[model samples]
Target chain A: MHKNIESQLLKLIPPQSKVLDLGSGNGEFLEKLSKKNISCHGIEIDTKKIIISLAKGVSVTQKDIDKGLKEFCGLGFDFVVMANSIQCLRRPLEALNNIFEIANECAVTIPNFGYWKIRLKLLNGKMPVSSSLPAKWYETKNIHLCTIKDFEDLCADNNITIKKRVYLDADLNPLKSWFTLNSNFFASEAIYHLEKK
Target chain B: MKIQQNSFEYKESFHLLNGGSIPGFELVYETYGELNPNKNNAVLVCHAFSGSHRAAGVDKETDKPGWWNEFIGPNKAIDTNKYFVVSPNNLGSCYGSTGPATLNPATKKPFGKDFPLLDVYDWVASQNLLRKSLDIQSWEMVLGGSLGGMQALEWSISFPENIKKAGIIAATSLISSQNIALNQVARDIIRKDINFEDGDYLIANKKPRDGLRVARMLGHITYLSESNFKNRFGRKLQDINNKIDSSINFEVENYLRYQGEKFSEYFDANSYILLTKIMDSFNPAGRYNDNLVDALRHCKAKLLILSFDDDWLFPTEYSKELHFAAIMAGINSSFIELSGNNGHDSFLYANEEYVSAISNFLNHA
Candidate 1:
């Protein structure tokens, strides 16, 4: 399953291209790319995690994404990733726009809030709580949870074209059916591959 | 355990260069690791402001461990078993080296406030003299943090052909405005103290302890993060029974006061004044008129810049700026923003990830 996801992520990324991982926790993905001889770097907020990434011998910077991406200007990476961290951003759309200018291709992952379990909770006049969002509403760092459809609309509004979509099962397996219907009821997460139009 | 101390005189004083009358001096320092016949295993450990040649092991006078005890030794990051590390006390510091605190030959009195405002370049020049005196031409790696990192950067640039690798942690290409302002406040506190006596307190045989303590307290605040402070002290009271006393109230307040009191014990007020002033003036990027990117382009060592996430004093943003500058300058650079809550002081503490990151970088670089 890991190998399959790796392959899919690899297929989307250009070979040996410079990659920047935003909110890169311990640089797990960057380490994978480094093994493939890719020039990978990252920006993380947690100091301890940055140390872990450094110990792994990955190049990363500890930075707050809310500030801006001024540090990355002119040194364009081919790919920029916002893996599992977009929702935690203070300004998700603004950060996405900054990422768009910093990299040629962007890969973003957001929990599918439209999933049946979440929809049912909302229908019952209750805030949604699922395994993906384990924290209490007040305690959660996820300030902007966007559904797959909502994200698609956002991309369209921002003039970003979707290159591919990968819907994951509860265990992060890629679903074989239409993500809108199948993922809404079954899948746990979704990743969107996007590029500027 | 062979130890030798030597000093050299320079005809043209750096003080003269900075419009002072004191003469330039040099300090040669060394250490023992496993020595190969070729001496290729030697590592140069540079000292930060107020630090001495005593980078590792025990100091005879204090009977205490070295300043970088946490990260140096047999199996530490800059392991003494694998690498021979030599850290020299910078020329203008009040350690074993000659500085404002050193006695002048002509006047038979300490340079005191008469010492010149020394720059980072001057410190590197003194190291060069030490290197020549020791007959050591090149170092495998130059390692340091803070002012030490600034010296490492200067070493890498000034003697690009002499160093193989450089590690700069919790430091900046230029001292930030905020840090300068903080130092200025500390200086002002000391200057305002009646005991300061306009830096001419040598005859009085008394030091400005109260002012120095306050200065140390203010400076200490910047070294720690809010999260760290909250976790360690929060709103916790110092003593349960003394709630109504309204003195030495919170644990955090007591901690800061204790830190200030202890710091003033061994450190001199004048030395603190000079060092803090030097730190304020430190700008490895050089004068404002010059482009910083062009100045950084001179670095030849494979670079590793480390910053802590909670280090608001020199935040991760600053390290990112350095990484970008180094990349723009076409230097083989690596940057890491470590997850730490200890703020700027994180580099001196034990965070497993930080150790690993540095070890891995050193092993690979």
Candidate 2:
């Protein structure tokens, strides 16, 4: 899953572009990105992750995503990426707007909370639990889980242009032949490439 | 690498921030790695409140490793092999530095209450003199934790062009009212002691050992988080030789008592009061229109600020304030909070993440 995201993110970024990653975790993705000649900086709140990221030669700052990106100057980064982290943010839309102010392009990956399997589990009178989201309801870090269609609507409301959309299955394998109209229910995860309108 | 305790004295009288001046003062320091001919590879490490110049390697007297021995070595985070590391004992300290315990050159008596009150700014001013005397034109980095962190921050602001980078760990830009209250309570305990003869306890041949012990006991509690206390000691009772007395019940109480007593044996009561005052008075935004962001504007070096999640004393909010200020000032800055159960003292512990953060900032950033 990590490798798949890396490859996909690599395709989106231009060589030598300055990138900022929100919720960059231990900076594994940024470290990998640096190998492709990209300069990556990250904002992570976890001390352990920040340390690991720093040790790997990634420039990561300790800052909460909820506070927005006021520390970064406008258009300082060519690209900004938030991987598997938007749902956990207290203000997902606000954070995205802040990132858009600092980067020309952005990418965000989120697990689809409205997948068919999840809908089936809900119909069976059980809270859906899957490998992508292993935590119990109370212990889960994600607070704003959304489906592909729900996210697209949010983008439209915020006047953000969805340049590219990719759907993937449970194992992170891209579903090339997936139906666009029912992607929200069929896809397990979705990655959206975004630009400000 | 081998570490040696070295000393330097300023023959010219140095003026104090509060009032008065030190006629002649000495600063004790330790060095790891050799100074390069160009002197650009030097790094100054300011010590915390009670810490001394012996930051790494074994001390000859105690035969124990330096307080920061784990973090500074050949292959450690702040590798001595690549940079020259200098750790200094602050002036108003009991540890091998000119302090209340030092004898007055004029009267042949311990300076005692006569020692001038020195703040973090004073320490930085004095340190700058030492830097110049050593023929160092600039420093590669100036790093410290807690009160030491305040000194490092002061150095960056006072001598911006002279420092290339700075690491401030578990520190604050301004001491809060609550923090001052806590220190006041500690100072009051020391002053209320019957043996504390107006800071002339040494002349009276009496020491405020009990008062100092109580102060340290309270400080130790503040240094540890609730979770760490519960995990380490909890409500577990100590083995008291089959006695049911109320003297020492919980293992935690015994631990605090032991630490307090051990500390009083080596640490001076007057020095404790003085150092805590300096810590309380630290305000990095003082000269820059009383605005933290404005003060940070003058800082030319790259900055790194670190805080611990469980460090309720300095806390993560303080680090954020400093980080935001650094950014607003347009200084190259980074901030991160390391997860720890040890609370404020987490900076002293051996955490891989903490090590890597410092190493990466120094080597890469």
Name the best candidate (by lDDT).
Answer: 2
The regions of model 2 sitting more than 4 angstroms off are A1-21, A24-41, A45-49, A52-59, A64-91, A97-153, A161-197, B241-246
Top-scoring candidate (TM-score): 2
Q: Give lDDT per model, in order.
A: 0.76, 0.85
Docking class of 1: acceptable
lDDT of 1: 0.76
lDDT by residue for model 2 (B144-171), tens: 9999888889988888988988899999
Chain A alone, TM-score per model = 0.91, 0.95
* Highest-scoring model, DockQ: 2
Return the lDDT, model 2, position B7: 95
lDDT of 1 at B298: 79
Q: What is the lDDT for B68 in model 2?
A: 87
lDDT (Cα, tens digit) per residue for candidate 1, span B27-55? 74647465457776667778776577776
* Residues A1-197 of candidate 2: C-alpha lDDT, one tens digit per residue: 37887788778877777888888898889878877767677888777777666556656777778986776755347899999999999999999988887887899999998898988988999877898888888899988998887999999998999998888876787865745567787788888899995
